[model samples]
Target: EAGVTQSPTHLIKTRGQQVTLRCSPISGHTSVYWYQQALGLGLQFLLWYDEGEERNRGNFPPRFSGRQFPNYSSELNVNALELEDSALYLCASVPTGYSNQPQHFGDGTRLSIL
Candidate 1:
């Protein structure tokens, strides 16, 4: 089974821009989660989507959002991106009906603000 993979590996942007990140979950997984690992943010859960619908979201602003495709792949969208937003975006996954399982992590898409 293929493990999770993230695109762009790294991204750089100025403040007040938009950024999009992608992720592909492992085979047979039905849920995907997004987490932001900023210097002070630690590993904060950004969003969770399952079966093509959003299941949960963290305390982040409305600018942080994402969606899951039918194939279980996912994308994260951030608008009006700020310098503080610069962080490593990680994607995680779990099998359907197994929320208790620790999620497998991607190498993460590093976002930088210039």
Candidate 2:
């Protein structure tokens, strides 16, 4: 069984530039989630999408958004990026409709703001 995978291992951007992170969940998974891990701060949940619909979102602003595709993959988009947004964006997924299922995380995309 393959685990989650993220693309563009690294990204460099300026303070107002937008960035999009992609993720492919393990086969057969239908629930996808996004998270942000800053240098000093630990992981923080960003968004949650299941079966192609957004189920929940973290405390982040509207600029932090994402969507799930028909194939169960997901894309996280951060607009008007700020220096504080520099961090590793991680994507995780789990089998849908199972409350006890554990989420599997992706390698993460490191976004650096200049």
Candidate 3:
């Protein structure tokens, strides 16, 4: 089975702009999560989607949102982007109804703000 895949690998955006990051979870998985890893801050959970429904979100503002597709792929959208938003965005996945299973991570998408 294939692991999760992230697109672009790198993203450049200006302040106040919007950016969308994509992720495709492993086959047979139904849960997708988004996280941000910045220089100072440790890994912070951004969003969680299971079975095409948003399950939870972190302390981020409303501008941080995402959705899971029917095929189990996911998209993370950042609106009103800020310089602080520049970070490595990671996506992970585990099978549905199996929350205890370890989530496998994909290569993160590095976002840089100009």
Candidate 4:
């Protein structure tokens, strides 16, 4: 089966700029998970968008938000980007009611802030 896919493999932006990262989950998946991996840091859960609603979110600031579409694709939006926001933004997906199952992840979109 095809794995999750993320768009714009790489992106560059300046501080205060806003960016949107897109993700398409594997076929049959209904939930999307977003994580941010900063330099020298482990993956940090950013948010979870499922079905068509914003389900749960991490301790990130309000500048971070996301949404799920009817097709199960998801988008992560970052406002007022900062240098520290530069990192690999990963997207994962899992089938509904299969929370116990491991989530499939994409290569991730690399965001760089200058």
lDDT for residue 24 in candidate 4, whole number 0-100:
97
Candidate 3 off by > 4 Å: none
- Per-candidate TM-score against the hidden true structure: 0.95, 0.95, 0.96, 0.96
Query: Model 1 compared with the native: what TM-score?
Result: 0.95
Q: Please rank every candidate by lDDT, starting with the best.
A: 4, 3, 2, 1
User: Alpha-carbon error at 28 in model 3, in Å?
Assistant: 0.3
Q: Per-residue lDDT for 8-68 in model 1, tens only?
A: 7999999999999999999988999899999975899899988899999999999998889
Candidate 4 — which residues are off by over 4 angstroms? none
Q: Please report, in order, the local distance difference test score of every candidate based on alpha carbons.
A: 0.91, 0.91, 0.92, 0.94
Candidate 1: stretches off by over 4 Å: none
**Native-to-model Cα distance after best TM-score fit, residue 88 in candidate 2, in Å:** 0.7
Q: Can you give the lDDT of residue 69 in candidate 3? A: 88
State which candidate has the highest lDDT: 4
Residue 73 miss distance in model 3 (angstroms): 0.3
Writing each residue's lDDT as its tens digit, candidate 2 over 1-114 gives 878999999999998888889999999999998989998889998998999999889899999888889999999999999999999999999999453688899999999999
**Model 3: per-residue Cα lDDT over 70-102, one tens digit each:** 999999999999999989999999988365789
Clashes of each: 0, 0, 0, 0
Q: Report the poorest 10 consecutive residues by lDDT, candidate 3.
A: 94-103
- Model 4: per-residue lDDT, tens digit, 1-114? 899999989999999999999999999999999999998899999998778888889999999998899999999999999999999999999998345779999999999999
